[model samples]
Target: MTGKTHIVGGIAASLAYAQIGNHDPLIMLGAGIIGALLPDICHGGSKIGRKLPLLSKLINMLFGHRTLTHSLLFLVIVAWLLNSFIPNEAVKAGILAGMVSHYLLDMATKNGIKLLFPIQMTVRFPLTTKTGSKVESIVFSLLTLVSFYYGFESLGYYL
Candidate 1:
């Protein structure tokens, strides 16, 4: 999936989670965006990676794309760190939700992801699509619609 797709997925995931948990949607929005793009830091060409080139290069060199960052180990460490550092429940939950959405979206791609890591096992959905392809565009559209729906729903707008 592309960065835009991940971003929309993050928004949709975060809003849905916020609504379900009765959290503040506003707080979740920004955190969700950050978390969604965090996993792609291993790819130097990613949105977050472009912003932090040196760190991106280092991570990519050390672990390669979709290796360490996309793994459960990274999620565990991030969860621990967020729990320790972030006092806002909404922010933490939003970030984690967004990251999970990222994992799910990437898993739908043909390249898949190393969810288990160290084990070298690739995890993906039964159906997959090429990154940035027409199928991905449709997925992006669906996520956008979901985001809009959740966005309004979280704001107490029932339409």
Candidate 2:
């Protein structure tokens, strides 16, 4: 999935999380976006990857794409780190929501991610699509609408 799609998924997840958790929509959205792009750090062409070219290259070379960074272990470690370092529950939840969204989106791709890394297990959905394909674009658009609707709905509660 593209970064934009991940971002939309993250926002949608944030909105969904906001419905059940006590958090500011804006903060959740911001954290969610960051989390969504975090997993793609191994791909040099990704949004976050482009920003840190050297780190991205190193990760890509050392681990390859969709390996350690996209694994459940990575998510667990990240969650642990966030829990230990961040005092805000809502913030941690929002970030985790985004990361989970990232994983789900990648799971829909043809080349599924090694969700359980070091175990050589790939978790994928029944239906899959190619990355950056027209189908993904449609998914991106639909998720955008969903995100907008939910985002507005979520904001109404705080407003």
Candidate 3:
């Protein structure tokens, strides 16, 4: 998943969390952005991957993509970490949002994501899309459109 996809995916996750968590949309959006990219921290091909390519590659090589990062166990730990030290609910929300978004986008790929990792379960949508596929471009585009629309709506409501 590219940065664009991560951003859109994050927005969607954040939006869902915002709705579910009943937090401010902006705060949730930030959370979503973080959530979207958090998983790839362990992948070398990803944006955050290059900075720590060796660690990312090592993780990917050892566990494979989506195995560890996509797991609920990891998410729970992440949430706990946020809740314990992050001070604000909004920041915690972002971490969770980013975590979920990371999982969801990987699910969109042809390889799919093992969201239930270590359990040997593969989680993917029925539709198989190549990572960075044309379909992903559209998905990201739509996410952007929806995000912008929502942003404008939010501005109107707030202003």
Candidate 4:
């Protein structure tokens, strides 16, 4: 999935989570955006990679794309770090939700992701689509609709 798709997915996931958890939607929105782009830091061409070139380069050099950063181990480490550093429970939950959404979206792509890392095991949905393809666009659209639904619902705008 592209950066835009990931962003929308994050928004949708975060808003849904916030609504379910009775947390603040606005705060989650920002954290979700950050988390969605976090794993892509391994690819120099990705949005987060472009923003943090030095860190992206170093991570890419050390772990390569969809390796360590995309792994469950990375999520565990992030959870630990967030628990230790971030006092806001909503922010931590939102970020983790967004990252999970990112993983799910990427898993739908043909290239797949190394969910286990170090183990060299790739994980993906049974049916995968090409990044930036029409199918991905459809997924993006669905996520957009979901985002709008959750966004409005959170604000007390039911429809």
Candidate 5:
């Protein structure tokens, strides 16, 4: 999936977290976006990778794309870090949700992700689509709608 789609998914995940946890919308959104982009840091050509080229290149050389970063181990470590250091439960929830959403979306791609890394297992949905294709566009659109709907629902809590 494209970064745009991941971003939308991040926002939607954050909005859901906000609604559930009564979190600060901006903080959740920011953290969620970071979470969503974190996995692709291994891919030097990816959007986040382009921004942080050196680090991305190092990661790409070391672990390669869709390896450690896309794995459940990575998510567990992130969640552990968030839970250990971040006192704000809502922000932590938002980030975790965003990260999980990233993996879930990637699972829909033709090249499935290694959800359980080091275990040598790739997980994917039955309906796989190519990245940057029409199916991805539809996914992006649907995520946008979900983001708006949940964002409004989150705002309702403020009102």
Candidate 6:
């Protein structure tokens, strides 16, 4: 997915986490952003993509695009890895929230995500916006709107 889609997915995922429980907004947003782009680490030229070529390529070869790395299982593993460093429930939640949102947004695209991964099940929405579609811009704009609203609404008084 593109950056805009990732941002939209991040916002939506963070919002979902906020709705579920009380936590720090910044932390949640951070996680969402990380998750949005985590899967693309296999793009062969991304920051992480370049660092872990073998792992990324292996994942890509085994699952194909938007498959294993986009699944709930993938999210959980990422959460576990993050928890090791953060060692906080809130942070772990944020990481998972972001990854799930990433996967969901991919599902909304034309190619869609193979959410079931190794199972070979393809999950897609009825209407896809196409990769790099205008929906990316519109969705990202809305995400920014929400972020500004909540970012300040929640953080302003504290600051």
Error of 1 at 45 (Å): 0.6
lDDT of 2 by residue, 49-123 (tens): 999999999999998999898999999999999999999877888888899999999999999999999788888
Assess every candidate by TM-score.
0.96, 0.94, 0.85, 0.97, 0.93, 0.82
What ranking of all candidate models by TM-score puts the best one first? 4, 1, 2, 5, 3, 6
- 33-95, model 4: which lDDT tens digit per residue? 888989999999999999999999999999999989999999999999999999998899889
lDDT rank order:
4, 1, 2, 5, 3, 6
Model 1: per-residue Cα lDDT over 1-159, one tens digit each = 999999999999999898888889888888899889999999889999999999999999998999899989999999999999989999999899899999999999989999999789999999999999999999999999999988888767332
Q: Report every candidate's CA lDDT.
A: 0.92, 0.90, 0.77, 0.93, 0.88, 0.71
lDDT of 3 by residue, 1-159 (tens): 677788887887676666557678888787778777778867777777887888898888888877887789789878888877888787788678777777777777778777777888888888878877788888888878877766655554356
In candidate 6, position 49 carries an lDDT of 64
Q: Any runs in candidate 3 off by more than 4 Å, and if so which?
A: 19-22, 156-158
Global fold similarity of model 1 (TM-score): 0.96
Off by over 4 Å in 4: 157-159
- What is the alpha-carbon lDDT of model 4 when measured against the actual structure? 0.93
The clash number for model 6 is 0
Pairs in clash, predicted candidate 3: 31-94, 34-98, 35-98, 35-99, 36-98
lDDT of 3: 0.77
All models, RMSD in angstroms: 1.7, 1.2, 2.2, 1.8, 1.3, 2.5
Better candidate by lDDT, 1 or 2: 1
Better of 2 and 4 by TM-score: 4
Looking at model 5, the pairs that clash are none
Kindly give the number of clashing pairs for every candidate.
0, 0, 5, 0, 0, 0
